[model samples]
Target: MSGEAAPALGVLRRREFRLLFSAQAVSVLGDRMVAVALAFAVLEIGGSVADVGLVLAAGTFPLVATVLVGGVVADRVSRRAVMVAADLVRVASQGAMAALLIAGVAEVWMLALLAAVAGAATGFFGPASTGLLPEVVLAEQLQPANALRASAVSAGEILGPILAGVLVAAAGAGWAIAVDAVTFAVSAACLLALRVTPRAREQQSAFAVDLRAGWDAFRSRRWVWTFVAYFSLVNLLWGAWGTLGPIVAEQDLGGAAAWGAILTAMGVGALAGSLLAARVRPSRPLLLAAFTDSLFALPLAFLAATSSVPLIACGAFLAGAGMALTISIWESTLQRHIPGESLSRVSSYDWFGSLAFYPLGLAIWGPIAAAIGVGTSLWLSFGMAAAMTLALLSVPDIRRLPVAPPVAGEATP
Candidate 1:
C-alpha cells in the first residue's frame, strides 16, 4: 500500500458506538418529553405567553453562560463521567418536579426552578457528549455515526410528543414528567457502563489556561468565526420562533393536540432529512447549510399571517427539513475539521456564540409579541431571520471553504 489504508466504515460497526447511540436516544426521548410537559404545565397553570417565554428563557440561560466552561471541563475530565453525572443531576431535578406535581403542591415556581437545574445539567452534558463521539467512533465513520444519532433523535422527537399527549391526557403533565425522569435514570445506567480511556496529553494545563486554549483554537479559524457570527442571528430568530410557535398554535390556531401534530410533522420531516444527509456529501457544508436558515422564516410568517393549522403545519415541516439538513452537515463538518482533543472546546464556542442571544430573544419575545401583537412580532422575526441568512451568503470565506478530504494515516487538524 502507498500509505496506511483509511479506517473502514466498520469502525461504526463497533459495539461501543451502538451503546452510546442507544443511551443518547433514550436521553433525547426524555428531553423531548420534558419539553412538551413543561410547556403544557405552564399553560395548565394559567400562565400567559409572556410567562411561558420567561420560563423557557430561564431554562436555557445556562447554555449561554456555562457551555464554554463545560467544554473545558469535558476536556479535562472523563467525558463519559461528565455525561453520566449530568444525567443523574437531571434525574434528581425532574424527580423533584414530578413529586411536587403528584403531591398537588406544584407551582409555576417549582417547574421554573427544576427547568433551570435541568438547563444547567444540559450545559455540561451537551459539550461532553458531543466531544466524546470521536473518542468512540473512528474518524472514517463519523458521518455514519452522526446519521445514526440523528435518526434516533428524530424518532424520539416523533414519539415523545405523542407519548406526552397520551400521558398528559390520561394522568396529567406531572406523570409525563415523571416518565422523563425515569428515562434519565436509564441514560445514566447506559453511560455508567461505557468504558473509554482518554489519550495522554503532552502537557496538562490549568482550567483557565485550557479555556484560553479553546478560545485560541476558535479565534484561529476564519471559517469557524464566520459561521459563529452568522449562527448568532440564526439562533436569535430560531429561539424566538420556538418560544412563540406553540403559543400561537394553542391560543390562535388550535389546542395542544394540534400543536402535537405540527411537532410530529416537523419530526417526520427531520427524520427524512437526516436519512438523506447520510447518503449525500456536500463540499462547503456550513455555507450550504446556512442557506436553510431562511426556510425557517417562512413558517414563522405563516404562523404570523394566518390561523390555518394546515398551512402552519406545512410550513413547520419545511422548516424542520431545513433544520435537520443543517444540523447533520454542521456536525459532520465539526468532526471532520476540528482536532478531537479540541472539538468540544471549539463546539462550546460554537454553541455559546450561536446561543448567547437566544435567552434574550426568548425573554423579550413574549413582551414583544404582546406589545406588537403576536402576529406582527412573528412577522418581524421572520424578516430579521431571512435578512441574516442572506447576509451570510456574502461572507467570502464561508462561501469559498471546501471540505478537507480524508488523508490516510494522518491525524485530523
Candidate 2:
C-alpha cells in the first residue's frame, strides 16, 4: 500500500473524525435500544400487532414527508449544527415518551406523537450525517471512514438490543427508553466539540428553486435513481420485517430476548462486513452492492419458515453483513461522484425515494400478517426483496457502473 493510502485505523487518528465517530457511535447505540424498547412498549400497553405497525407508521410518515426540506436545510446550514440540533430534539421526544411510559399514562396516540417528533429530527439528521463525512476525512480515506462509521453502528446494534432486552425485562421499557434519551444528550455534546470547515454559502434562492435543482441532480444520474428505486422496495420489505419480526419472536421464537439475539447476530455480521469493506475495493461497486443487498431476503425467508432462534440468527447475520457492505460502497460512491454543496440534497432525494413506502409497509404489515398469516406475510416480503434486487441488476447502469479510479497520490486497488 502507498504511504498515502490510509491504514485501517488511520482515519480515526484525525481529531474531527474521532469526535464525529464518537458522537455517532453513542447515538446509534441509543437508537438501537429504542428500536427494541419501543416495540415492546406498544405491546405492553395491551396493543396488538396492528398497533405496533401504526405507531411505527406514525413516526415514519413525517420523516418521509419532510426529508427533502430537511435536506435543503442541512445543505444551507452548518452540518454539525444541524446534527446537534437534531440530537437535542430526539432527546426531548424520547425523554417525554419515557416519562409517559414510566408514569403509566402512555396512550397509543401519545406514543405516536412523541415518535413523530423524533422522526422529524431524524429527517434532518440523516441528510446532514451523510453530507458530513466527506468534510471530515481525506478522499483516500473515505472507504475506511465509512467502514469505521458502519462498524460503530454495528457495535451499537450488537450491544444495544441485548441491553435493551435485559433492561425491558428488569425495569420495564420506560427505563430503556430513558437511557436512549440520555445517550442522545451525550451525542449532542460530542457534536458540539467538532470544528468542521464551514460549508460554502449558496446563492440565495427560493425554496422551490433549490428543491428543483436537487431533484434535477438526482434524476440526471441514472445509476443513483435506479438503485434508489430498488431500495424503496427493499426498504418496504425491511419495514415489514421490522414491524412483524418482534411479534413473531414474542409469539413463537422466544420473545424479546430471542429477538435481541437475532439482531445481535446481525450486528456481529455487519461489523465483520464493515471491516472487510475497509480493505477491499471492488471493480464493479454497484454490481457487488446490489448482490450483497439481495442477501437481506434470507432472514425474512428464514423467519417465515422457522421459529428456531439459532437458525434465524444465521440468516440475520448474513442480512446484516450484506447491508453494511452495501452501505459502505454506496456512501463512498456518492461522496466521490456528487458535488459537496448539493450532496445533502441529493442524499435527501435518495432517502425520500428509498423510504417512501416504508411507512406504508409498517402500517400494512400487521393487517397483512393477520389476513394471510404472519408466515405468509414474511415470505411475501422476502419474495419482493429478491425480485426487486434481481430487477435492479437488470439495469445497464447498475450492472456496469465502475468504481472511480483512485486519486493521483493514492494506491490503485
Candidate 3:
C-alpha cells in the first residue's frame, strides 16, 4: 500500500506472469490446507499418531526421491506441460482420497498411498515451476514476481490450516480434502491458459548425462552450494525449536490455541515482509537475505526465555518475516544467475540439499530435548545456529555476490 511498493505491482500487468502467479497462489492454498486435512483424516479412520507420521513421511520420501528426475524432465520438455500434468495428477490423487473418505471406507494405507502420488506430482511441479516463471516475465520482474508469489504462499500458510480446520469441524475431513482437490483443478485450468515458449536447449543427451549436467551446474556455483550447506545445518538445528516449543506451549502457556496464534502471527509477519521485498531491492541481496534469515534465533530465544505468549509470538513474527525476505531474494537470485536450460535441475539440487537433513532434524530433536530439558535444548540450538550463521557470513563468495543486471529485452538468457 505504500507509494514505493505500488511500482512492484507493475509485474502483474504482464499477462503470462499474472496467470502463473494466480495458479501458484491457488495451488499453494490447497497444498497447505491438505497438510491439516490429511492428519485429521488419519485420526478419523482410527489411526494412531505413528500412522499420521507414517502417512506424512510417505508423502515426503517420494518427493525427495523423485525430485531430481522431475527436474530433468522439466528441462527436457515443456515446463507448462509438466506443470499442467502435475496438477492433473494431484487432482486425481486428492479427488480419490476425498471420494474414499466421504464413502467412510478410507484407510490409513489408502491415504498414505494417495499422498505419495500427490507428492510425486509435486516433485515434478516444483522444478517445472522454477523453470517456467523466468520464461514468462522480463528478468527485471523476477523479485517482484517472486515476492507476489511468496505473498500468496504466505496467505496460504496463514489461512489454509484455519480453513481446513473449519471445514473439517463443520463437514468432516473428507470435505476439507475435497476442497484441496478443487484447488488443484483450478490451478490446472490456469496453467492450461498460459502462452509462453521455453528457451531452446539441446535435449539429445542421455538421462544420466543430463542429470550429471545438473549436478555440475549446482556444484560449480560456490555461493549456491555453500548457501545450501549452511541452511541444511540451520534447518537441522531448527528442529529443536519445533520439537520443544509445543511442549513449552502446553505446560506454560495456554495450549494449542496459543500455539496457533503464535503461528498466525508469524504468517502475518511473512505477509508484511513479502510486501517489503516487493519495494526494496538490495545490492548485496544474498548477504541481506542471510542476515534476515538468521533472525530465526529471535524466536528460539523467546521460547527459551519466556512463557509469555505475546512476547514469544512477537519473536515468531520476526522469524517469519526473515523467512519471507530470504525466500523471495533467494528465488530471484537463482532465476537470475542460473541458466534457463539448467535452472530447474539446479533448483532441484538446491531443494534436495535444503530438505535432506530436515527429517533427521525432526527425528533427533525430541530425544535431545528429553536428555537435556527443553529450555536448555532450545538455547543450545539457538546459540549453535547463531555461531554457524556468523561463520557462513565470513565466506567471501556470499559477501561479494551481486545482483544480475537486467535483461535487454523480454527473454531470459
Candidate 4:
C-alpha cells in the first residue's frame, strides 16, 4: 500500500467489511441528520420548550433501558441478524415519523412515542455493531475498521446538521427526517448483504443467566470496568459543557454561530484523529487512549477561562479529536481483548455505564450554573473530569494492554 493510502483501504477492500462499513457510514449520517431535525420537528408541531425536552428524553431513556437486552440478544444470535432487525425497527420508527411529519399530522406525542421506539432499536444496533466487525475482518484489521467507522461518524456529525438545516430551510424538518429514514433502509439493505463468520451455539441459556454472564465478563476486566467508571463520572461532569457552553456562548461569544463554529471545529478534529488512529499503531493502546481522553477537559477549561470564540473553538476541536481517538482505541481494545462469544453483552454494560450519567449530567449542570456562575461551574466540571481521567491513568492495567499480535493464533477476528 502507498504511504498515503488509508490502512482501512485493505479492510474496506474485502466484500463483507465493505458492506458493514458502508452500512455504518450511511446509518451514522441518518442518525446525525435526525438528531438535528428531531428538535426542529417538535418545534414545528407547536411543542412547548418542556415538550422538546420530554420528547428527547422519551427517546433516550428507552435506549438506555433496553440496550442491555439488545446486547444479550446479539450474543445469542447472529450479530448481522441483530443489526438487521434493529435497522428494520429503526426504519419503521423513523419512516413513520417522516410520514407523519410530511403529512402535517404529526403531534408532539406521536413524535415522542416514535422516537422512543427508534431509541430502543438503537440500543440494540450499537452493541451489535461493536460485536460484528470481528466477524468480518482479520485480527489486525480491527483498529483500522474501528478507526474508519469513527471517521464516518465524525464526518456525519459535521455534515448531518448542515444537511438537516438546509433541508429544514428549503423544504421542512420532515424532508430531512425522511432522508434519515431512507439511510436506515439503506443500512438494512447493506447489512442483509453481509457474509459473516458464523459461531456455533450451545443450548441457549436463560436470559437472566446470559445477562449475568455479560455482567461478569464486564466486571472481571479491570481495565474495562475501571475506564467505564471513569467515563461514567466524566461523561456526567462534561455535561456541564453541553449545558453551560451554549449559555456562555450566548453571553460572551457571538452566540449560536460561534457555538456552531466551536462544534464544527470539534467535528473536524475528530475526523483528523480518527484518520490518525487508522494509521498509528500505539505500543500501549489503553494508555495512549486514556491520555488522549484527557483532552476532553479542554473545552470546559477554555470556556471557563475566557469568552474568546477562537480559543474555545480550538479547545473544542482538540476535545473532539480526543473523543474520536479514545473511542476508536477503546472499541478496538474491547474487540481484541474480550472473548467474541459474549462481546456484545459485555459491550452493553460498557455502553450502559458510559451513558448512565449523561442525562443527569445535562439536567443538573444548568441548575448548578444557575446557583454558581457559569464560569465557576464550568471550571469545577473541568476539574472533576480532568481528575477522573488522571485517576484512571494511574491504574496499572491501562498501560498494560499491548498492540495487536503479529499473527492470529487462537484469536480469530
Best by TM-score: 2
* Candidate 1, pairs of clashing residues: none
Native-to-model Cα distance after best TM-score fit, residue 53 in candidate 2, in Å: 0.4
lDDT of 2 by residue, 274-353 (tens): 88788878889999999998898999999999988999999999999999999999999888878888999999999999
Global Cα RMSD, each model: 3.8, 3.0, 3.8, 3.5
Who wins the lDDT comparison?
2
| Model 3 stretches with alpha carbons more than 4 Å out | 1-3, 39-52, 99-109, 169-172, 239-257, 301-308, 366-380, 405-413
Q: What TM-score does each of the candidates earn? A: 0.93, 0.96, 0.87, 0.88
Mind sharing the TM-score for model 3?
0.87
Off by over 4 Å in 4: 1-6, 40-53, 99-110, 169-172, 241-260, 303-309, 369-376, 404-413
Q: Write the per-residue lDDT of candidate 3 for residues 24-118, one digit (tens) a residue.
A: 88988887677567766776789754465567666766787778999999999999999999999999999999999999999999998998898
Query: At residue 158, what lDDT does model 4 achieve?
Result: 76
Model 4 agreement with the true structure over 1-413: per-residue lDDT tens digits = 46635567788888998898899889888777776577667768887444555666677778879899999999998889989998989888988999999999999999989998998898998899888889889998898989998999888877776677677767788988889889999999999989886898978999999999999999887888988988888878876775566567556886444655676778788998898888877888889999999998998999999878889879988998999999999999899888889999999999889878876676677667777777898889988887788898889878876765336654322
On residues 1-413, what C-alpha lDDT tens digit does candidate 1 reach at each position? 21221222344468788778879888878777766777877877777787788778878897678898889988878889988998999999999988887777777877888888988888888888888988888776777678778877888778887788677667777888898899899998988888787666747888899999999989888778878887887777776676787787677866666777777777777777767667656777767788865577777888888888788878877877777777777788887888888888888898888888888888888888778888888888888887888788888877766667457785322
Clash pairs detected, candidate 4: none
Worst 10 residues of 2 by lDDT: 404-413
Give the TM-score ranking, best first: 2, 1, 4, 3
